[model samples]
Each structure stands twice: as structure tokens, then as C-alpha cells.
Target: MATETLTYGNGTSLQASNLPLNGSSAGKPVDIAMDARRVFEVLKNGGLAIVPADIGYGLVAIDPKALERAFVTKQRQPHKRHAMIGSYALHKELHVLPEREANMVELLTRDIDLPLGVIAPLKMNHPIVQKLGSETLARSSVDGTLAMLVNGGKFQDELVRLTSEAGLPLMGSSANLTGKGTKSLVEDIEPEILAVADIVLDYGKRKFSEPRPSSTMIDFRNVEVLRFGACYDVIQDVLVRFYGITLPEDPGRGANFSGHLREAAKR
Candidate 1:
């Protein structure tokens, strides 16, 4: 299928339809209703939407079939688990958060500037976790269990609306295939990856510091640094001071501690 490239403006302003009337390479977010509709129309039909996220480029898929297609497009491993893009409206359902963890996660990732992913706890028997497969979850889990990624931004509002409209769980994953750099610029995305999308929602290239192309991922349940990219030290500081959480043994080395959170467990 020919992937349509629609020029979309960057940032969190969700007000007013600025859909370009004439032919142009770019436009602001369409009206709230229209924006929600367009995204739903594509994803509910098993199509992929490659768009700029709070982090790097990501592909949003609401079903297993669409997810498979996204994995193939990214040339990712079949068993690799994808992260859920989260919103406040859907948080209670998306995560198995204790009141404390919920409040902490909310405070930590409340910006387009703070690029962090939270791996919150999930019930092993939960429908979404079961459908995602225990094996996949185990592989990606900090503790070899089921978890979710909280990629939050103002854009999450539209995602919340889309999920409500479609009534399907969503999977918002990095656009890159396994082993590829998480690309920040539209053109930096491999054409083969872009071609698989139903449409490319261009909000312009993201402006992030080097050595970290994507968000840093940590365990909300244990506060272990899973993967360090952007805002690594700052998040570590916040977690330590506010929550009495200890820093990861290998903070920026992307070490996996088998989900152990206690500093004494480090050896």
C-alpha cells in the first residue's frame, strides 16, 4: 500500500483544526474530533500510523495483527514485547499501580521534555498481558514478569480518545526495527520501515541531545534503571530524593538486574 505522508505540526496544542485547505507539505493537528477520527480510522482497520511522539518516531497499532505488521516493518524479533503509550484517562486500566507508584510515575513523566518510560507492574492473567503473551513480557520485564511502558505527553490525550473510540488496546512502539537506532528525524527513518505505515504523520524532527535518541526506561515498581537514554541522571536524582529509591548499579549502561530493586541486591 502507498503510505500517505501528511505534514503534521509538532507540540501538544490539541485545540482547533488547522487542516490545510490547499496542498501543502505541513499542517497543525486537525481538530480534536477529526484528529481522533483519522487516527482511529487507520488503526482500527489494521493500518499503522507512523508519527512523531514525545520521544523518537513511533508506530501506533491497536491490535495484534497491526502489531505484527509493525514488528515486520521494524524487522524486530517476533517475540519482543511492545510498550503501551499511556494517558491519564486510561492509567487505571493500563497499569497495576499502587497509589504511591501511580503518583510517582505521574510526577516523573509529565512532560515532552522528560523522556522516560516506566515499566509498571501488570497482572499475569490480565487480558492485555495474556494477549501480549507471557513469553514476550518475561523477556522484556525487569523482573521477568509482565510490565507496561508509560510514554506520556500532551498527545496522550488524543490516544486516550482514540482507544475509547476504537475499544481496542493500543501498542505504541518505537518506529525502528530491533537493532536500529531510534530515529528522531522523519527522513532518518528507513524507507522500508516508513513504507509499511498507512500514513506518515510528520511533526518535524525532534530536537534531543546526542547519545540518547529515545526515552530512558525504568521500573516504576522497583525504580531500577532499565535503559538510560535521555534525562537519566535527573530521574535518578528525583527517585532517590523523593521516594528513597536507590540508583541503579549500572545507571547508564542499560543493565538488567532481573527486576531487583533493592540496592543491597546488587553484586
Candidate 2:
């Protein structure tokens, strides 16, 4: 497929917006066919797209080179790990859990409003992670843990399905540069990042505010709160309200995977 090449810096960005602002479909949004076609072309060709995410737009792609390009565009450090949004099917395949907790973990992370990330140990080799990013990939290989995001929404599910069809799990990171404030609005993206992306899917701004963060991340093995970014309060309530389970403030008490918890430069 010949991809429509878009470049930036002359004056304006070559946006893959819903519709050309002044054309025949000026006021009409880009139909699903055009949208999906662009998405397929970007991922298939190692191109990058800034697509809508649960919290904000995300730098999405299945190609390793595209992922690496995102790392550069975000100005993110090499030590940061990129989280992936994938189907329950892929989640079940990649994350190896004890029989007693597998189902429970799935219940906690999937089919929810707040995006949740599960850090599960790899049951088998996922060479695809190498393409996702190096900083986190190197760390995860040593730690033996991978963070997987499971989104149940139809839109996100479609992307996951597409990734599966392509034979790779979809991986992405919030489109924000490190240390800068997190941004959910399309207009908030830095020019440098926009310039590098092959396509920018700009529908509009997001609804959530500071209180709302990206997916709340937890370790899959023990259900420890890795970071209370998004839906931290609601998830905590959901655990106890429905399942009669309460997370330990210090889930590290057992510390089953100290190697994973500890920094590994010297390991």
C-alpha cells in the first residue's frame, strides 16, 4: 500500500484529521474506512500515528522502528517503559499467572472505565517487546515483568484486534514528553513530536482533567499499586466493594519478586 506521506515544519502540520477543513467533506468527519485505512498503513509501514487513547492521544504502532522513533520524539529517557493496549486473548497468552489469581486479575483489569495496566511475568519469549522500546525492554527482560493494558471499549478493541490480525500486540506510550505536564488535548502536543509522527488523528480535546490520569498501573503477581495515575480511587473501591478484596498499602510485604522491584544496573 502506498502511504500518503505527510511532512511538517514549512508552516503547518500535515494532519490526518477527520476531514479536510475546506474540501467537499469540509464539515464531515473522516469516515471509518479512511480512518482504518490510514491506521493500517501506518502500522504496516513502520510509521507512527498519534491516535486517541483512554486518557489522551497516544503514540501508537506495532513496528519497532516506529516505537524507537516515538522514544526520540517524546524526548523520553531510555529507562522509561512503554505500556501496551491489547486484547484479553493476548493478555491471557502473555501473562502467566497462578491459577488461583488468573481469573481475578482479569476481572480487576478488564471491562472497566479507568484504564488499568497489569505488570505480568512473561511466560514465554515476546521478541516483539524489543520493537516496543529498548529502555523498558532491557529492564523488563531482566525483571521478567511486562506491563499490559487491556481496554474493553469498542474503539480500542478494534485496534487490539487489528494488532492481532497483524500478528503483533499494539504498544504505545502517552504522547507527552518526559518531565513536561501530561497533556490530553491534541493541540497540546509539542511541535517536535507532531513533526515526527506520520499521522495525527485529531478529533478534538479530551474531557478528563488533572484528577484523571492515564491507566492506574499495578503489578499482576500481587496486585500492588505501581502508580496511582488514573481511577486510583475507583479501582480501590471496586476491589473491596465487589470482590471483598482490599489491597495492602504496602503490597510489597511478601516481596516475592524483589529482583523485579529493585533497580538492575548492578544486577
Candidate 3:
């Protein structure tokens, strides 16, 4: 397979390999570190990039202008906030939650090996929280809380690690126009979203392409179901069987196309 240079709004061009990173029989081998580093550099320097995760592809940015561009490109609503690309370490340091709620997060991300979009109160004085300047903070947070993805996938984990080390918070949403549904494959991502990205990691199709488009987002404050997304069924079961908390049944995509219980949750 050949490598192609992908250029985007930030005027940065990256040589994206058409092959998968691991030496799978399907294609040639690419270096995950090298690719992640390049994407991190682009994002760190105020550029937008689309990267793959287990649940879906996402568009991430650190610059306020770039973040605004992403929102415009997606035509996302004003009320929707971008989720933070975060790790357990980052979550422990930045999110403020009760003991049981925090334990639930640990159980889901570490024990069950599930990905989650955790919405919780932010530790306002945390260094990483302070690092996200005012504009980024305003765009990424809703009220006093912020949503962060935990254990998304190998690629996202690496990216979060990089951002954490650099003291730069990465905030983004699923790489698709709002309401159009999350995209699981880089090739399936809309060209409009791709065009706004400075670099894109085309890591073939994501792992969880069925059941949902993105990670199941829960507001830890009250365990509200903001979005019934990927791995939702398993998450719902674990919460009930272990924590004895039952989440509302998914109405399926037919009734709730986006799977967002916004009205019921009042989010």
C-alpha cells in the first residue's frame, strides 16, 4: 500500500499510511508512535485532526479557533459540548466525583474493559483544568462539568497520554456532522470533516462498529444517560448487577436516532 499526504485547514500535511499499524495479514505495518506523535504535534500547534477510536473516529483540537472551526464544520448545536480525550490518570486528577461514582468509573474502564464517556464535575483548580484557557474551557465544559472518554482504544490512549504529558487538554466530538451519526471508518467519515482536519489517522474500521456509534455517555452527577451509545447494553447490565442501578431501556434508533435522552436527562 502507498502512503498519501493529507493536507487540511491548518496548512499542515501528513503522510498517512493506507495500511494498519500492527502487522496484520491485511496490509503493511505502520508505527503507532510515529503516527500518534505527528497527530499530537499537529493538534498541539492549533491544528485539527481526525483520529480513530474503538467506538468511532473523532475530531480533536486544542486551539480555540480550531475548536470553533470543528463546531462549524460539524454544524453542531450550541448546547453540545466537546468531550475530552482523557485517561484514567487524567480523570482521577481532574474530575471531582463521589467515592462510589469514582469507583464505578474504575470498575467500568479497568475491570470490565469497557470504554465510557464520563460526565462529571471538573476540579477547577487542577493544573490540566487551568491549562485549558478560558475559551477552550468554555467550549469543552457544560455548566461546571466536563465529559471525558476513558479507555477508548490504543490510539486514543496514546494521544491522551501525550496531551496529559504536554499539559495540553484535547477536546473533541465524534468525527461527523452533528445528528448525522458517528462514523466508525476513516473512509466513511464525511469529506467535510476530513477537510477541516490537519491530519487524519485512517486506521481502517473501528472495533465496535455495531450496536452504537460512540461510547455511552453518563453524567456521573446523577448517572443520567446523556447518550445510549456503544457498549451501552453491557454498561447498563454492569451498573444494575453490581451497583444495583438500572438505566432506562434504549428505545432503539428508530425512536431515538441519536440515542440522546436529552429531554429526560434535561441535558
Candidate 4:
């Protein structure tokens, strides 16, 4: 099928008509309509698109079937999970997490400059979340400017509407091969990934700093840090302040780390 294209503008008519939200398609090749709502729809329909972030642009696909194809194209392992991004509205549609976890989501949504990820449980069970483990879900949000690149202005609302309409949670992650540089445009993506993609949204070329490895993942299930990444220190501080729990000083095994945190708490 021919890819659909939509030019986002400042007009509210598009939002009222839900035109951008309706354009997203799954299982069929559809060019990104260029609106955040539309992109969300495309993702919900199992289509693939590219998103530009403060750090850089990455690939996004909401459909599990499409994601499987994306992983193969990027040579990404199935065990490694993807992240999610959208407006606050989109975040609310996700699983109803604990207040503390909800607070984290609010904090990230409030700060447009911080490029962080939220690990929570999916609102509902699905093969994707099941594969990642039931204890957590991934959530993220790009700055408004980045949202505008895809959808003119109502980026957040559009995202919420599309996801709600499709009843699918999106998998957000950087668009690059594992341990390789992230591609900025649809054309730059490795051909392997492109071949399996149902839709390829091109936002043109962009310069990016050395890709920051994936965000550190924390399993709120036990309120423990799982993998340490760029946001480790920040997450540590948050957990400590909010839950009165301290993390380990040493950056080693769980036994050692937990022991360290316990020792510090005692003091």
C-alpha cells in the first residue's frame, strides 16, 4: 500500500478531525503522516516510524509483529527491550502504576530537557511486555519541539489519542544497531531493518553526539536498580529520597551492592 503523508501545521482543525490520528496503519506499508498523533496511530496499527529527540532521532514501532521485524533488521536481541515516548496524556493511558512510580512519570514529563526512561508495568498483558518480564514497562517522552517535528503542536494529545484508539502500547528506542551509531533519517537506517519495516518515516538527516547507551533500567517491583546507565545516579537519588532507601556505593554484583546500601542505611 502507498504510504500516507500529512503535513502538520498550527491549525486546530486537524486535531478536531482526528485526521492525523486516523492515518496510522499496521501490517501495510504507510509513509508516516508527519504528525505526532498520526505517528502514534501508525505505530498502533503496527507501522514503523522515526522520531527526533533532544539527543537524536530514533526508530519507533508499536506493533509486536513490526517490532520483531525491526529487531531482526537491527540485529537487536529479543531479550533487550525497547522504550516508550509520548505526551503526558499518552502516559496516563498506560498501566495504572503506584503513586511513587506515577510521580516519576510526572517528573519526567515535567522536565522537557531530561532524556530519561520510565520502567513500569504494561496497562495490560501482551507478548511484548511478557517477553520483557511482567514486573516492568518502559515509558519515555520527547520534548515538544521534537514532537512538533512529527506533529505540528498538539503532539502530546495526538499521541494519547492514537494510542488510545489503537489500544496498543508503543516500543520506544534509539534507531541504531546494537552498540552502533543511531541513524537520523529513514534512509540512513540499515537496509536490513528497513527491509522488514512496514512503514519508514524520514525526518531528514541530523547530527548526533555519541549515542548514550540505553537508559538504566530499574525494577520498581522490588524498588531496586537493575541496569546502570546514564541515569543511574539520578534514579539512585530519587529512590533514596522518596523511599528512604540507599543504593550501593560499589558498582558491582547485587550482593555487594545491596550490602553496601544496607550498610549506608544503618549509618
Candidate 5:
């Protein structure tokens, strides 16, 4: 099968061409109606695809059953589940979080421009979220003008509908291989990863000051910050506003941690 290639220039345009009609188109953008249909066919046939994340882009396997393949390709640990990227409207729909979690989502979506990540509970059982843990699912919005669906297009609702119907939460992560900095264009991705991918919807190079990593991981299960990244301050600020609780300066460990939060929740 012929490989599909896309060129992401400096935030100008994203163009996809030369994609095999029956191959995976997971992480790539599906702008045209035919492209979207063709990609679905390939995915139905067990093909793998890649997609762009808000910061960079990501690999998405066609077979929801084969989510592990995408993670392994990125050399990411199986336990670290990928975040789901969807539209603001869809986020409002699929979200079946508790009042506290729902309140947080409202706050984040209200301030949409700022990159926000929410560690909320999942309503249905999904392989991706289940693999990580049954407690919470992390979600964020993919913002890019060129790549609408992945980048917040009207089709974003379609993507979310498909995923929700399939009972699968997309495992969204940066396009570059694990531990590597976020890549700006298709050419910047590693060849090994690109080789297995079915299609690449290049949006050209992005013009961001620096590669903004995904938001920090705050596990409500543990009520702890797993990793510090882009949305640390914003998350803390939101939590305080909604819960009337102040997070510690250092989220590492001590008397104040998830344990304390859990205890307070019970009270």
C-alpha cells in the first residue's frame, strides 16, 4: 500500500494527499467528506491512523481494540492513558462527571482560549480510560485553525460523536515520539513512527513561541498532580475557585495530598 504524506508548514495550511484509499488515517485530518469516508473504511479494515494534538499531533490506531499499538509505538507506558481531544460542545455532551467535576469543566470551557485539562470521571467503560484507571479521564481541546476537526472544526462534533458511539475515548498525545519535543510539521516526525502510520494531515509548521506541553495531570483518584506541565497554575486557580480549597505550593508529598482531599470529601 502506498504511504500517505501531509506537509504542515508554518501554521499556514494543512494538505493531505497520496493516502492509500484502504489504509489508516487516524491522526490525520479529514477535511473533505470523501477523505473522512475513506479513512473510516481503512480504519474498519484494521488500519492505524495519526492525529494532531493541541500542542503537537498524535497517533491514533484505527482499531479501537488496538489502542496499545499506538502507545507502544510512542514508547509510552501503558499506564499513562492518552487524553481525549474534542469540541467544546461535545465536551459538554459526553461529560457525565459529578457536580464537582462538571463544575470544573464549565469553568475551563468558559475560558476556552486558555489551554485547560480536566481529570474527571468517565461515564461509560472505555478501554483507553479503563486502562489508565476507572477513576478519572483527562480531556482537552485541540486548537488549530487549519485542521478543524482535530484543531476544533465543526467536524469536531462528528469525531466526538463517533468516539462516543464507539464507546472509545481517543488517546490524544503529542505527535512526536515519546520524550521528544513536539514536532511542528510532518517532516519533523520520526521515520519509524511515520512508517506505521496510514496517513498524515500536515497543517504546516505552527508559529507558537514554544511547544506547550499538555496540561498537568491532576488525578482526582489520588487528588495529586502527577506531572507538572502547561496548565498547573490554571488548574490550581480553578480548583480553589470551585472547591474553596487551596492547593499546596509543592504538590509532591506531605500531610496535604490526595489523601487529605479524599478525607475532606468524605466529610
Candidate 6:
């Protein structure tokens, strides 16, 4: 099949290509760096992009208007918060977690190599947080905490590195319509969502496709299970064994396919 090229509202065109799943091939490293750079350039300038994650595909934007456009495109609820695309370094710099909580984040994201959405209090004075400005923050944050996804995948890791270095932040939710289960492959992403993206990075099928479409989200502040998503059982086991913290059992995807315990957990 011919490689597809897409043009976005930003006037830049992106060539979409198939990436080897999990970056398994020798060519994957260079392919990932190049694709990440392309998507990063789009996001940095307020353009939207559909990018793959281990948990699922995601819609990310940096500019407030772009963020609003994505929210509208997804028909997202007003109370739903966008998650920050993050790395271990940015999490340490941005989240003000206590030692124990911080250690848990390190173990899960770094040691265990899990894909997790970590909600924690943020450092208001952090440059990236400051750069987000008030309008974006209002939509992307909870009371005083921000949800950040760590170790989502290699492409996301590279993208976060660029955002971190530039002191910008990428924020968005699953690459699907509101209340719709997450899409693992770019092609499976809905037409509305695809139409809004300035570019789409087609990484083929992702690591953690449905019936679990997103990363397990936790409010480290209270060790609450906000969303029981991809790798829930694995994370639960690790927490129980290492920290003796027993998270509430995932009610199974059939009961909670959207992965939230409540509408409030949509963060």
C-alpha cells in the first residue's frame, strides 16, 4: 500500500507510515525519532495529532484553541480533564508527591515498565505548568492535581522528551469519541477524531488494545483507583506485593468498559 500523507489546519503536511509494533525492528528507533519529531512540531505550534500509545491511541494538543478543538471533536464532557503527556523526569519535576508515593511512581513507571496515568499535585511554579496558562489549565486539571501518563510507549517517551526540553506540555485523552472505547490502531480511530487531527501517526495496532483501551489511572494522593484500564491486574499485584496497598478490584471491562468508576473519574 502507498504511504498516506495528510495535511492539517496548520498548513503542514505529514506523511503517515506504518511503524513496527513495539519498535521491534532495527529500523524502529530512527523511524520513531523522525515521526515523533514531526508530531512534536505540529503540537508545539497548537496543531492536533493522533499518536499511538501502549495503552491506546491518543489525541494530543499543546495550544488552548487546539485543545478546545480536540475536546469539541471528541464531544468530551465539560468535567473531563485532559491528561499530561509525561516522562519519569517530568513527573519528578512537576508532581509534588510524598516520598512513599514518589517511590511507588518510580517503581511502577520505571522499574516495572508499566503504562500508568498518574494523578498528583503539580508544582504551580514549574515552567511547563506556567506555560500551560490559566485557560488550558482550567480544562486539563482537577482541583489542584494533574493527570500525567508515564511510560505510555517509546513514541510518547520521545515526544515527552521534546516537550520537556521545550518547556511545553501535550494534553489530551483517548483517540476516540466521548464515551467511546479507545482505539488501538490509527485506522480504527473514528472519522471525526481523525478529521480534527493535523497529522496522524499510524503505528498499526498498539500494545494494550481493547477490551482495555487506556492506562490504569490512580490518584496517588489517596491511592484511589480512578480508572481501571490496561494492566490493572499487573499494577494491582505489584502494589499489593511491594507496598501492601490493595486497590479496588477492577469490576471487569464489561461493567466498566469506559474504565471510570464514575463520571468524576473521567480524568
- TM-score per candidate, chains pooled: 0.74, 0.74, 0.88, 0.54, 0.61, 0.88
Candidate 5 per-residue lDDT over residues 130-208, each given as its tens digit: 5333232332222211011222333334545565556545444556577675565556778767776766655444432
lDDT of 4 by residue, 1-267 (tens): 334433222222211232342234442222333456556656766687655443445566766666666666677655555555554555454445688766665664454223344445544444433433323232122111011111112333355456645555555566777655555444555655544444444434443232233344444444555444334566567657766778644354333332223333555
Model 1, residue 55: C-alpha shift (Å) = 0.8
For residue 130, what is the lDDT in candidate 1?
59
User: Considering TM-score, which of the candidate structures 3 and 4 is the better prediction for this target?
Assistant: 3
Q: Write the per-residue lDDT of candidate 1 for residues 1-267, one digit (tens) a residue.
A: 445565544432222234442123234353444545566677777788876665677887776667777877777655556777655445556567778887777777663236567677665565655555544455445443434445544455676567754555667677776666677877777777776788666665665535466777776666556566556677777877888887753433244322223432455
The whole-model C-alpha lDDT of candidate 4 against the native structure comes to: 0.47
Q: TM-score rank, highest first? A: 3, 6, 2, 1, 5, 4
Tens-place lDDT digits, model 2, residues 67-142: 7788887877667776677657777877788874676665665545456677788754655554445654663443
Error of 5 at 73 (Å): 2.1
Segments in model 1 whose C-alpha atoms lie over 4 Å from true places: 8-33, 111-113, 123-147, 207-211, 249-267
Whole-model lDDT values for every prediction: 0.61, 0.61, 0.82, 0.47, 0.48, 0.81
For model 2 the TM-score comes to 0.74
Preferred candidate (TM-score higher): 4 or 5: 5
Worst 10 residues of 2 by lDDT: 256-265
Clash pairs, candidate 3, are: none
Considering every candidate listed, which one attains the maximal lDDT?
Answer: 3
> What is the Å distance of residue 252 in model 5 from its true position?
15
Candidate 3 structure quality by residue, lDDT tens digits, 9-64: 23233444453343233244445666678788888888898887899889988877
Report the Cα lDDT for candidate 5.
0.48
- Clash number for each model: 2, 1, 0, 12, 17, 0
Candidate 4's TM-score: 0.54
